[model samples]
Target: MHSTVILIEFGAIILGLGLLGRFAGRLGLSPIPLYLLAGLAFGEGGLLPLGASEEFVAIGAEIGVILLLLMLGLEYTAADLVGNLKAQYPAGLVDMALNALPGAAMALLLGWGPVAAVVLAGVTWISSSGVIAKVLADLGRLGNRETPVILSILVMEDLAMAVYLPILTALLAGTGWVAGGLTLAVALSVAGLVLFAAVRYGRVISRFVSSDDPEKLLLVVLGLTLLVAGIAQQLQVSAAVGAFLVGIALSGEVAEGAHTLLSPLRDLFAAVFFVFFGLHTDPASIPPVLLPALALAVLTAGTKVATGYWAARRARVSARGRWRAGGALVARGEFSIVIAGLAVTAGIEPALGPLATAYVLILVIAGPLTARWTEPLARRLAERRRARTPGDPAHGRPAAEEATEPAPVPD
Candidate 1:
């Protein structure tokens, strides 16, 4: 009877998710927010709290996060990551400075102390790669010229996480300086070794993983990724990073086949992951933090736009593409929660989780809308400004060459 009850609960959850997904599709919106809402509805303080399947959902959510990172890694090779890191390290720095500072400043103003400030700084620094990737794919902008600039920034951020997560873990643990340093050293060494292997032996690894049987191929790749992710977590490095590195190490037919087999699994687990985030956030806790969360969200959104514009302009992408790039980078998701979750577990600040939850909720919904509309809105504003200015008296052309260029061709 207990087993049957668990199955029934799990089955109902899946069915509900499927319906919600279809509804979102019909409305031409991403289903993430809706999925999160469903989780909230079934969580504590909701109309019908979950019981039998809650533990199982938690496990699924962890897999969801790992799979999300792995699939993201499969999209690029070690060579791509290396080139992006070398070329776009400056943007990453700029991103950290502009976006991270606001969160830290807010925490200090609220008298949350230095630890909360550091935690919040990380919360604000990283954008949601998963959400942004989905938006790009939905809008067919993956081939856009500016996408490389956007992608490079994301790669730089992911690489930054390898260094950042270890340090954060040490700080949260309140380890001594020597212990922290040692932890950071181990994380760096592991990351460096993985990158080297991916770059030097990617082809060989892919060839070995490739097989004629799709079933065998899927199991091998899944098993290997899970094993590596578990080991990475055990080392306090980050399972997501380990999964991503595994993806980066494979190329050619193996990568393609793995991606094909795992895409569905990634989607399923990713949805579960988002839902799990919402499940932990009590609705009552969000009200007090909502005001601050809104303030921070508005402030960081603008800074993110500026970062994107500067990066795209440096890349020589068009004005529209620059806006698109900025808009694309506005959302914060899994990583932000992961950071806050650490603090919550440590009992650093009672309000931090609620703030982070509210912040992510607002942006995840607005992100896709911004990605879809920021360019058009920017263009309209630019045209209004140009119209207000007198055209060149001596030449038939507009005062700015950018004024007359065609819309950026979609990729």
Candidate 2:
């Protein structure tokens, strides 16, 4: 009877998600918000809470996260990561300052303490790669000139997580300085070793993993990723980071094959992951935090746009491209939840999870809209401003043109 109930509940959840996804598709919107809403509806204090399928959803959620990072890692080679890191280090620093400071400041103002502040800072710092990737692909902006700039910032953030997660873990654990330092050392060493191996032996590793048979290839890649992710989590490193490293270690045909084969699985689990997040948060808890979350979301959205515009301008991208870049980075998703989840599990602040949930829901929904509209809106605004400006006789151009003339800035 218990098994039957679990099956029925799980099946209903999946069917509901499929319907929501289809509805979102027909309306030309992202299905993320719908999935999250569905989770809330079926979570605690909701219309129909689930008891039997919660454990299954939790496991699927973990795989969703792992696959998300792995697919992201496959998008770039180690050399590309190194190059972007070197060229875009300053932008990464700027991104951190602009986006992270606000979240930390808000936490302090709310008296959540330095620990919760740090965790909250992480919640706001990183953008949603999964959502952004989908938006870019949907809009066909992958080949846009500003895309590399946007991608560089994401790569830097992902690499930063290798250092940040371990440190956050140690701090949350209240470890002594020596113990924390040891944890940091181990994480850095593991990351460095993985990167070095990827740089030197990527092709060889791919060759070994490559299979002509699709079934065999899928099994090998999935099994290896899970094994590495598990080991990394056991070592106090992030499972996402481990999966990312495995992705980094495979290149060429193998990476392409893995991406193709695993995409459907990634999509399925990723949806479950978002729903899992909602399942944990009580719908009743969100209203209290809604005002603050809305304020923070609005503030951070502008900051993210500014961050993207500045980075893109520094790269000498055009005005429209810069706006596009900024808009693309507006969404916050899986990683924020992962960071806040750790703190929540540690019993940090009771309200932090609710706040993060509301914050992410606002941004993730707005993210796609911003990406689709920022460029067109900026262009229209620019055109109006140009029409209002008097032509300069000396330069034979309007003031707006003078202001936006692209300068050649070296990457």
Candidate 3:
């Protein structure tokens, strides 16, 4: 009875957040930003100050990211990866590097300690795939040229933990250098092989699991998801990465509607995670640090903007179109919090968790404000492009799609 009550108490907090997100979505606001705001409001930082336990909230947040990655794996195909790369192969790499490198350098310079610097670098490199994908879908731009670039970058971001997190975890566990390095290499290799094998033979293997028994298939998927996750834990890998691979493996292969099986569980707990992160952060500490947090936010936000433009310019995109793409890429959500949270877990530094949390809070607020502003900028650019090219309503079509006239012989 006591256990049930405790579960209900924690459950209600997250349930309420989802309800709030739905209401916000109805008002033309994005659910993720509102989700973060609700977290802030019901959090220690916000008015309510829930005093929620960090461990509890972390579970929810972890599941939220887990579900997101799984769903992405299901939707993504190697062809999709190839297409995404073709559109903007180097964009994500550039953005993450530019963002992470400078951040690490600054952290080192600040006398903040190596752990904090490395954590900042990792978090800065991540872009919110959940946020970006949702926003792009909402605006009906998911299939456009802009989208391929976005997707390519997002996929790279998802794979980052495979490379960085395992080593971090091993070090924190006090494993010897040789063992930690070996574990890291093994984790990457395992994940790569599994994913590569799945992609290469997905179409063939998926056929066997194609059945009408949604419940049964879902159970099978759960077994696989947890098993892979356990393997990752044994390897000192991030569970989120394991869950992602599981989801990727299960994607499109299980029964048609089987994806629905995990939705309720994902939702119920993801709320708890948001509230936990909010609770872990002490609002009183925020005042003295507000200025630096704000300054850092501005620097990162500006860098993302520049990153989008640089990618666009490399692709020979127009000045206005570049700005629109840049604008669209500005929103960052789960990646920052997840990486920061992992840093604390990895024991890379002390008081580092709180610092990372503070920085994420800043990004949460800043991301939406930038995204909101970009909406109008994109519209204006489209209008100008259309108006300037009166003869071609669709602007420019590729040579393959156009009807070519036969060339005249010598005059």
Winner on TM-score (2 vs 3): 2
> What C-alpha lDDT do the candidate models reach, one value each?
0.86, 0.89, 0.65
Q: In model 3, what are the clashing residue pairs, if there are any?
A: 57-273, 61-273
lDDT of 3 by residue, 59-153 (tens): 66766767666666666765565466566657867887778886687677767776678777876777777667666666666545545555666
Which ranges in model 3 have alpha carbons more than 4 Å from their true place?
33-58, 82-89, 174-176, 251-264, 316-318, 346-351, 375-411
Candidate 1 lDDT trough over 10 residues, lowest sum: 392-401
Stretches off by above 4 angstroms in model 2 are 391-411
Error of 3 at 160 (Å): 2.3
- Superposed by TM-score, candidate 1 places the C-alpha of residue 371 at a distance from the truth, in angstroms, of 1.1
Candidate 1: the clashing residue pairs are: none
- In model 2, where is the ten-residue run with the lowest total lDDT? 402-411
What order do candidates take by TM-score, descending? 1, 2, 3
Q: Where does candidate 1 stray beyond 4 Å?
A: 391-411
lDDT of 1: 0.86
Please give the lDDT score at residue 270 for candidate 2.
Answer: 89
TM-score of each: 0.95, 0.94, 0.81
